[model samples]
Target: MPTKDHYAAITTTLLVWGLSGALFGALFVGLYQVSWSLGLPGWQTLLVATMIAAMTTSAFYSAMPVALVGTMAGVLASISYLIAFGLKAELITIAGVAGVAGVAAGSLYAWMVTRGSRPLAEILNGLIAGLLAGGLLVLAFALTGWQVNMFVLAAVAVACVGTLFQLSDGWLVDRVAHWLPAMLSAPVVAGVIAAVVGASIWFIGGTTTALLDDRMTAALEEILSSIPSGLLGGFVGGALSGLLLEFLGFRLEAGR
Candidate 1:
């Protein structure tokens, strides 16, 4: 059903976002490395990066300052909890923090964007949704008993639930959400998109390498040295997956 323009928009958007996301991906990963080097907790770095992704992507897609602030608050709240209850941090604690933060971020975005008659209802809905999401994720984890870090799981739940809670009424939003639950439901779509973009980036890189094999290969190597291929690949991967949230109708335009 999409026209040529739609496909064109998709291409352009992917290029720009993919590049930008590469920058973020590389930078965040670098920060994590730095954190590890500095002996900071891995959970700290992971949670912070995850929160940043959630906040930045929400702002980029939703065009809502409120969303950014709310997400920031959510991030801060999680950190504050960790700081306050360092040794006593439990799974419920992480889940509760994620749920509360998600609700705050999602409700604020929904409220500011919708201008609907039921802002409170939406926020409350988000609250319930966040709590339910956190609880469900926790229960799922308990059943399967993932060996991964709890903070990462918390972050995933918050990100997914936050976006879900921010759903506003729109034809496109509803339509897309049926297939993609605000970026969470359709992992395969997001993964496939990211993989394709990454492949494209690598292909371009390979072509450039071939073009300069004889003359400017040194220059190419220098450039690659400066711009890490891994970072670039990360950027493409993030861009591919992050923007799908928008396409999935997570970011609702005003008045449908």
Candidate 2:
């Protein structure tokens, strides 16, 4: 059976992520809106939204580390948006400053979460996770000419995977971790996650966007395309992180 904590975390993630996404969409609806929203850049908005969600899931334990995960994910999402939409110089600067902050924050969080193990390994793992996922988001946007909305889907993917890892004191993650060689488990998990997110984005809004973004609206085609991107990106991310994690001894402790 799942613990109370698992139930709480899932609920928190569901609400926080969902609300944050909605808020972001509403807040950034127009050029004037973006300027009006306290003059903060879109990425900062994402960071704040993610931070709010992370606080809920990470509050009791791993709170700080979880914050790092959210911050990095948001910053990278912003960078991918820039690339996908054709870079605006302002956004590039935003990406750079946020990237540095993300690195510092990620390093601290990795050290906190991984104990005495090399913090760089977990930090790198998170970075690669962002990169692989971001690449897929960029590719999909470039090909289809969709807006930068896939980050919401990516957030769901990360949340589901992260929540799964926290279950039964990491029992679920450990079961999978042990079943596959540490070397291999990372990519499998990553691919599954990316595929799920890709498929999810397709089902959730790709269909609708088809009618919108200039009849560039081939729902079936785009959904089909996302599958491979998910798989390929997942494999790359999984392999790199898996190997590094194994090297860093980043095993989860299960139920007592």
Candidate 3:
């Protein structure tokens, strides 16, 4: 018994969530790279990069009111990276954790914000969905020891950037104003967010690379190679979860 408006809202929410997840993943990648590249100590790079990224991303989507969702997603994404580091003690592990966390957090936040009528139910469902998404990415990473290279990293970054620009200039603004459908706007927003996130991750990786001694650089590279796949996992997981929520009949509003 859904109306056209209802369907439209659901679709838009999914797109936005997915796009946001991807962008956030990219930011983590960039942060990791920057941290390593800068020769800063452990965690210091991550802390600075995350704060900057959170502020930057939040400011860009200030009008969406779901800005907090993005910020929360960022925090969760960072936590994932930290968890990965603790769990596997590998750079790739960190990447995997970041991706899973971003997808889960972003999807859950979007669903909760959009499903205003049943906030509690929506949140419960979203949490389940997020957990599943994160779990899946971790599984995928385990199954595939993906490697990251400069060329591969650059490709992901460019793709995310293209998507981000599309969101900033395209339907995202209109979607926020109720002037356009979320499906159209969400993807665009997700793309931009992904790019920004990727940049942050790259930053972290680069920083890590610089700090290590020559003897450790090769080992670091091997570990960092898993980042690209981790990012992809996070982006896809988030998008799928958001889409799943929409298919199940959730509605989203302009701001939470």
Could you give the C-alpha RMSD of every candidate to the true structure, in order shown? 16.2, 15.9, 14.7
lDDT of 3 by residue, 69-185 (tens): 443454456555544543233444444444444445545555554523222222222223333333443354458865555334433332333233333423333333443433323
Tens digits of per-residue lDDT for model 1, 40-124: 6645554444434333333334333433444454455555665776545543454356445555555555445543323223323
Stretches of candidate 1 off by over 4 Å are: 53-230, 242-256
Would you estimate the TM-scores of all the predictions? 0.34, 0.27, 0.34
List clash counts for every candidate, in order: 1, 2, 49
lDDT per prediction? 0.43, 0.35, 0.44
As for candidate 2, its clashing pairs are 187-238, 210-217
Q: After superposition, how far is residue 243 of candidate 2 from its true place, in Å?
A: 26
lDDT of 3 at 234: 38
Better of 2 and 3 by TM-score: 3
What's the residue-level lDDT of 244 in candidate 3?
51
TM-score ranking, high to low: 1, 3, 2
lDDT of 1: 0.43
Candidates ranked by lDDT, best first? 3, 1, 2
